[model samples]
Target: MNTQEQTQLNMLKKALMQSQYATVIAQCDDVLASLTSPEAMREARYCKAVAYRLSGQPDLALHDLQQLVTDFPDYGRAYQEQGYCYQRQGEDQNATYAFYQATRFNPALLAAWQQLEQAYQRDNQIRALQLAQQQISFLTSLPKPLLGATDLLHDGQLFKAEQVCRQYLQANKHDAEAMMLLAEIGMQLKVYSDAEFLLESCVTLYPDNDRAAAAYQALLSKLGKFPQAVKQARRRLQNQPHNMTIQAGLAHALVGVGALNEAIELYRTLLADQPARPALWVALGHALKAAGDTVGAIEAYQQAARQAPDFGDAYWSLANTKTYRFDDAMIESMVVAQHGSTVKLEDNIHLCFALGKALEDNKQADQAFSYYQRGNALKRKTLRFDISRTEAALEAQQQACQAPMFAQPGGCHAPDPIFIVGLPRAGSTLLEQILASHSMVDGTMELHDILGIANSLSHQGNAYPFNLARLSDAQCQALGQQYIEQTRAYRNGAPFFIDKMPNNFIHIGLIKRILPKARIIDARRDPVACCFSGYKQLFGEGQEFSYSLRDIGRYYIAYEKLMNHWHRVLPGQILTVQHEAVIDDLTGQVKRLLAFCELPFEQACVDFHVTRRVIKTPSSEQVRQPIYRSGMTQWQQFEAHLGPLFDVLGQRTNR
Candidate 1:
């Protein structure tokens, strides 16, 4: 949207808030016509719909609300407005459903909660009534400004939410809920350290508050503080022994810490009592798959699908196994579920990806790509990744950390970590598996401490790569030591450990500043093959670019540009390992890798497929067997559908 249109939208929103309904409704169309962005259009339409309903045009309001909700399925305010329209029209059932949807998409919609409370009480929906009552009570009890801030937070207006919360907290520093809400906004903004500090203060002040405890546990987990998360979860469970949520949280923490047996047992125990919960089944399936029991994982995933036919995660979980082939009946069921009444955006995305995989396995290339594209389009709606931010960060790294910056690097000199940095789906995991096969090397899951530290450091006054050059030797050593201390729980006593975090390629400068002696490997692949592979797969978190073909291709180009900068700056510091080279000459590549890391040659690294460890990546199943030639040229089959990707990647495929 242009500045003038955005300014008009801001004015229209204020006018609506002030009950200037005629003005808001009149100005919305002109403001919307000039606004080209989907988000801007959504905001304008919502304002118009709300204004129409308040101005006594119930049918007209419902018409626009219906269109708005259709276009932006996850817009909670649109559903809320739809509820108000339905209520005014005396369509009680429709109002009830709309209010329920509003609350589901955004729990901070106080009016929706109030409406649902009344509807549930009237209709005798006992479970829903209790939930609605709880939600309404929570929302109603908040301070008025915090309440507004809460709604803003739910509506994706984080800047406004932060402003309100900061103003309120300036006078009411000890308000726990306000503190929690602000901390949550910080998390949304990726200001992890600030969020951690706020959550810690909130929890310390209100030790008995379950909400504070829950939020603290969540933030801890998100930052990869798994042991701390486990501790918090255990404490919460101790306080409420029968709380299934706390039990599940602990199970997830256990999985994060690689205590798979305990996590699996905990999930099974939760399932024995609550077998009807499809989410629990899927969680158990994840644990089982991470532990390499594919059969048990399949059974768990299938049971979840059977329990809730519209639960798309279960079907996607099955497809994500990388080796699972869906039967005709299963595919038919997924098709029906995709079109089912309870289908939502996430379900549609999951079903599309699963169906794409099913069709691809059956050699239906065109149909497979169609589903993949649909899934990517839907998935992109749910992410907020910015290619511009990525490019800016890369440019800043180049500007801040040149050869002179590396010259002053007197870091911790810790030779313990071997960092594997690259783009996802570029065979980083395969390299980790091979190196981990060496007796001196321990294969930890893609550790998050590096990214977490980078995030925390970025919150400093100057941001990350720029601030990195200012750290003194002592400060750099302390930060590097902090990393070692934080990641100690994930490692065994091996002299060397592999930290195969692919996106760490972007943080190479920071890595050099902290751990100057660390072994860095840059995993590379054929651009088209890597981009297409990433586009088709669904990641659990943080590889948002993979959701779209053009985005993934552009990310690759950007990644290559940054890596080239690193190579020029650091000379022989980073070893660029092509995925194809390793596949073709395992022995030769293994020896070369060991030579770089200063490890003696080991035959086990060459025969890495047989070395058993818990692999958690999507490549787990494929990397467990010997290398093959089949997947290298698989992108050629879908070449006809990859026009945008080819344009973005400059047609880098050998084929």
Candidate 2:
């Protein structure tokens, strides 16, 4: 709501509390008349409900309260009002239940708690009365500012919550709860490292606090620290062996750590106990797919679809496998689900992307692009991608890592990591697969270590690349060793492992300072094809620029400039592998890639598609097949709607 609307709301609330029912009703009507937003309309309706209740229209008040609670389940005041309506109608049991729900959502609702205590006593429920007493006690024990902050956080007023939390923390330096709340705000703001640090401190200072440990584990999982998350999950499970939630967390962590068998088994056991849970089936499908059991994965995905017909993730999972062909029934189901009101925005987005892929595979280019654009547009609403910020960061990388730094650098001489760095959908995974097929290189997932390190070094005033110049040689060496040690879990005993994190291209200078001897492969692709591919595809995370054609185009330009700088400053230290070149000359490119990494040529490199491993990228299915030229020009089908992309690519491509 706007400032004027909020002022009007406060006035209406005060009038209602003072028993000025007629005034509140009239003011609510006026506010509703001026309000266009649904949230504002709902708040006005709530005020109107209070006026109606005070005027002895209990039934009308109950109707409004029920509708409000239906629309927003977490609206504690609506539940409290619902209880009042029930109490006025002599429905003691219903009043008690509604009051319980009110306190469940917001424990600071002292009036609700008192009403609940009275209702429980009248009903002679001693245990429930004690529970209500404990809740009230807990709320009273918490600082008023912390309580207000908690309420604000629950209401999604993140900035206000952060302010209150910071104020509380300033007064109480050891306040773990306040730190946790601030950490939650940081997580919501996508400042992963800051959140991580706060949660780490909370867990360390309060080791026995399950809430802090659980929050830390979740943050680890979010940051893709699967091994660390699994460690935390294991510790939590040890203390609460029968906790199904913790067991599920452990299974998810297992999946992240590549323990596919263990994850699949845990999921199967969970599914057997909770057969109706579609998420478990989805998890099972992912594990099966990652383990290369395509048939099993298909069955698991189909089971998930059967369990929840509108679960778009299941359908999207099938489509994302890239080998699954959607039947007519499946296509109809996805389209219906995408158009359904019951499906959430996230699931609807998945349905749109799935339908896009299915239609594209069926030769419906127009419909495919429509769905892709729709999905990207929906997902882009949640991201904060700044083109200028990205360009500035790239410029910092160029400026900070001049030739002098490289010349005086003392980096860890560990040539054990083969870095495949570039934009997503740029054949980085393909290059990794080819190199990983060689005997010397172990194939790892897109490692988050470099990104995590960069995030750790980054701050509000100084982002990464710019901050790299401040690191001494000792710090650089430590960072390199940290990367190697952190990545040990993802490797076998192979002398070299492929870290196919595509965005790592932006951190090549940092990589040079740390692991200077590490092999860096610039996985280059045609700008039009690469950008359009990213536009059509839905990555799980990062690559936010891909949601818009213009953003991706500009990012591609910046990426090209940075890569050129790396080549100029480092000179022959990095190798460039063009996607089209690889497709055209697979054998020659394979030899070149192996030679660059100081490896002898092997037939396995040429037959990389046949390499048996867990492929995580969207190109997993494609990399399992021989090279084809069709995908190189697939962007041409959607050229008419790509004016923004072409405008950015002007003078660089023959548009």
Candidate 3:
């Protein structure tokens, strides 16, 4: 925003705070007329609409807010004002949906959350009401500055949020809520250790704060500290025997620890009392699928979709199973639910993906690609991804790291981790499954420890790889040991574990600097196939680059460049495994991979589909069956929609 527009906005805020609605409306109109920037105009329109609503001109307010939201879909204040206007016009359903959009866009909006709770309660929407209550309780405990930080975080302004929270903390040293909020921002930025330290401090300072405790446990779980998180959840549950929140926490932790039977039973017990909860049903379905109970999982997912037609996760869960087929009626229902403006942004995105899958299954390639494009476009609007930053980081790694850096041999000597790294949808999961099938290798979730260590050394101006030169041998060894110790909870006494975080391909130098003995595998696939596959899939979090075809292709180009640099700097350090090579010769490729990991060959590795481990990727169901060549050609069906990817890949697009 320009200086003049900012001044006008500040004046509008003051007028609204002082209940000068006429002044707010008039000033907003004048400022909007003078502003040419879309952002400035949106801000002005927001102020005017709110003033109109407060002045009892709700219809006019709704019209203006609707236009504002259509132009800028991520504006939370506009959605909240639209909710107010809808409520004034006696349209309770529209009001509820608008309120939901408000909270979804900016979770720190306490008023939006409270209004949603009341709307849900009035309509007796049991599951929605419970979720809104939990959100309200969580937000109400945060400090005011931290609440603003949360809104900034949700708006994809990470650096600004961190700055505000850090400034608040510098003045108020003992504020637990500010620390927790900052920790959350750290997690979102992929700096896991800072998040861990902050959450640890918050829990110590405010032991009675359940929200902080829950967030701390969740961070631990994300770091693959399953045992510690489960233990903490159990202790909390024991203290508060009737607390459903603690019970739910335990159920989630149990899933993390691979105790599928216990988790399923706990979910069933919980659902017996609150069967209307769609999220619980989705959780149960996940557990059942992990336990190889496909029929039971399908029934649970169907139940969830039936109870809450607008709950996008439930429908997406069914589609993500890979084996489940959406019937015609179900597809029609999704299409109808996605058409209205009042549908939540997330729900609409989910419907787009679900519809894409349904049409793809029916061989309607053109229609399927349309839905896929819409879904990606909608999702991309909410993410803060800069391709140039990624390219610069890769360039920095090439300039700073040389072959001599590896000659020092200055990291921890433990060969406990085998990392499978590459682009998403590039067959890393399949490789992990094969290696995890070995008795000596434990398969864990995508561990964030290495990324955490690398991110701690990064600054806004200087990317990683450039930051590694400042670390001494002692510091490197300590960081390596910290990773091993923190990840011990995810192991079952195996000699080695696999951390298959795909994005770790960017941090190969750091991984080698810290854990010199760790094995690295580069999982590669056809560029077009991989990028297009990622474009069609919907990730729960992260992987923002995959939401656009051009972004995905550019990311692939950078990834290929970095991997080539790694090979040049540290030759013979990484084992390159082609996805097609594995499919064509499973026996030989399995032996080659085992040789790279320095492990004895076993039948279990070859018969990986029957190994009975928990798989947590989009390819979960695909890996549960025998290896097939179908996915290699799946992208060809929509080749017309993938010209940008081919353009980026150039000669690399040859299949």
**Over 4 Å off in model 3, which ranges?**
1-64, 71-74, 87-97, 107-164, 188-190, 340-342, 459-463, 651-655
By TM-score, the best candidate is 1
Please identify model 1 stretches exceeding 4 Å from their true place: 1-3, 10-26, 36-38, 51-60, 88-90, 652-654
lDDT of 2: 0.85
Candidate 2: segments with Cα more than 4 A from true spot: 1-144, 147-160, 460-463, 651-655
TM-score computed on alpha carbons, candidate 1: 0.96
User: What TM-score quantifies how close candidate 2 is to the native fold?
Assistant: 0.80
User: Residues 1-655, candidate 3, lDDT per residue (tens digit)?
Assistant: 6788778888898898888999998777678788876666777788888889888999989889878877677888888888889999999888888888888788878999999888888889999999999988988877788888988887666888999999999999968778888988998887887898888888888888777888988887777667778987876776688887778778888888788889999999999999999889999998888777778988998899889888788888888888789999999888888896557788888989988988998999999999999999888866657788878877888888877887775778899999999999999989999999999999987877777677677753465677676678998899889989988877889999999999899889898998999999999998888899899999988888899888889999999999999999888989999999999999999999999999999989999998888877778888888999988899878987788777777743335
Please write out the lDDT profile of model 2 over residues 123-148, one tens digit for every residue.
Answer: 88999999988877876777889888
- Put the candidates in TM-score order, highest first: 1, 3, 2
Q: Score every model by TM-score.
A: 0.96, 0.80, 0.88
lDDT of 1 at 52: 92
Model 1 clash pairs are none
The local distance difference test score of model 3 is 0.86
Which 10 consecutive residues of model 2 have the lowest summed lDDT? Answer: 150-159
Candidate 3: minimum summed lDDT over ten consecutive residues — where? 646-655
Query: Each prediction's Cα lDDT score?
Result: 0.88, 0.85, 0.86
